[model samples]
Target: MKSKQENITIISIVIVRRFICFFGIAIIFVLNGYAQINELSIELEIVSISKGNYHPSPQELIKGDTFPKRIDFEFIVYNNSNKMLMIGSNTRCYYHSDGKETNYEEIGRFLMINGTDTIPLYTDRYYLHPNPHSSVKAIWGIIDSSKDFKACPIFTPFLKRWTNVGKDNTKELYNYLKSSRFVYVPILADYQRVLDKLNNKSIIDCIIYPRNTLEVKKKEPFSVFVGYLEEKDYDYIYPSEYK
Candidate 1:
């Protein structure tokens, strides 16, 4: 269980992490047959994000330490692909140091869609150490996964609840994890990082550098879906002054 102070830290970390786009590097593993690539597009919107404190379920804790709490992020996603993209919640977590990400782990999951079948994604209430260093300062990215259901391809980060809270939209930190109120994001670029790697692998990974702070401004209420295909992949690559 986390103490009240720790809860605040957890929420702060989540909000900070949201600013960083999680990169999906190809997993270094054996090849499994590649799934047919269908036109896939993702849309996301985070309405409200806030932090709070709570206790862990295990009930075992250090004498002076409380369970870590987490921030709750209320967000939405859409899948505008030609074929159905399977998305699950349990996503990946990465930490950064000196402008590079080093710590990576797959924590929990969620399901989402391109307006086909909508789902909500939440985070576990308890705060897991964002990093090992005491002065840990870095952004995080939530990468989606495809391992929830067997043979489903599992598009990581499909919006779904990861809380044990009974049908309640508003829940405390501890109950959120117990009831599965968390969610995840899919990593289209990092297909090779899994235990079974995909066959047809070409690095489609991208880094978006918005020209000015005002360039990629969000028009609130709705979501924003950006598309990027590497220069070599397309015959005629559109030139962007920002890049």
Candidate 2:
């Protein structure tokens, strides 16, 4: 893992909440025994990263900019409804564990930064145009990945957008993806554990923040292989935060 950086800042949006109510949710579901999920999905994908304090771009860089150490990822939403799902104007991310709610001061935060120019990048925070309010506010937190949990994610995990199989939009959003039916929100790291000591090794956990959307009540065993980050050898596994 990389060393800890004293210079940290509170991000604008915090996305993590563990709410278990009563609903069964899964990344993949079948309708009438056919394999497919809902119209939209909030999925997670792994990315290999180097340890350092860096900014994704000159625009993203601020006073105390540092690459998130724990979790860094972007949430992509695919709309197969053949229609545009209106993006919302608000978002909230407050966490709770075992019935204990945290105060506003306990709200976690992370800097949203892209991994690479892997694809065209877009963020709801900066999406501006005819309707600035049209953007997906990625609200999430460390909720149990159990379907039995009353509150779980309803969206499924879609494959990489650039891939041909699930390739819904490789060239859909030419200029601003944030304004399109598909949205990408990058959740940088775990601010709650920001001050924790580094593992002092080149290998550290690389978690892609979330893999679903909407609060649900379901219990299904998920999260086993934890992905790891090391020198570009690309072999992987890190602590599975989803379960």
Candidate 3:
């Protein structure tokens, strides 16, 4: 015959052990699911590019010339299919020149905008390659050494040959940009939120303004995860601009 106090203590211990075991099992199941997700794969392509901001005339920065602080450009993306798609968070852009590929560090993230008529994803902006149309644009904001510019150059030759690179290059320029595809894995938390929005119908577009050129081609296919929209409705005004 056990006393009341002793019985209470024994019961408490049993409950505690059961809780610990249950928690451990839950953790294991979660890990196993995540591992399976990592094994999945997807394909992405740049469907369209619109005319953003074009300079009246290309500006040149001489040894003693002063350059503008920032430039703006507008580009649109087309998801290309009815299938609801997620931008591979791991994709990165790779820039190659001077017998090497440079690095393009990510400076911004993605945005989701539910417009009055359309749903569009506006990507995070980067400090590299702000204005791709600038002939004299410096690859990196800093021009300490010419080697730094190896990857940042606008690929003037490529652009000259393919006028539609900014419009319909996905089909015509796929071969040249084949290496353009790289790991586009989304950030962890973001990837989960995006994955939850399955079976959406809309165009997934990311607007990117890079500050560095050579670095763009040297990395994998990376774009800000501007969320998906209703394909039919896609317009959002920044809070500052909203009236």
Q: Rate the local accuracy (lDDT) of all candidates.
A: 0.28, 0.27, 0.30
Prediction 2 global C-alpha lDDT: 0.27
- The per-residue C-alpha lDDT of model 1 at residue 240 equals 24
Per-residue alpha-carbon lDDT of candidate 1 for residues 1-243, written as tens digits (9 for 90 to 100) = 999999999998987776552321233111111221112222223322121222335665433232112222333323233322232222322211132445342333343323344333333222332122222111222322322333342322222232222231222322322333222444433322431242433321221111111111122333211122222222221122111
> 1-243, model 2: which lDDT tens digit per residue?
433442222221221122211122332232411221354444433222222234445665453332212222333333344332322211222211345434222212222222332221211222211222322334222212121123533211111122232222212311122222323332223322321333432322321122222212111221122223344442232223322
Model 1 spans > 4 angstroms off: 1-41, 49-71, 86-189, 193-219, 222-243
- TM-score for each candidate, following the candidate numbering: 0.22, 0.22, 0.24
lDDT at 237 for candidate 3? 23
TM-score, structure 1 vs. true? 0.22
Q: How far off is residue 5 in model 3, in Å?
A: 4.5
TM-score of 3: 0.24
User: How accurate locally is residue 201 in candidate 3, as Cα lDDT from 0 to 100?
Assistant: 22
Model 2 TM-score, 2 decimals = 0.22
lDDT of 1 at 90: 28
Which candidate tops lDDT? 3
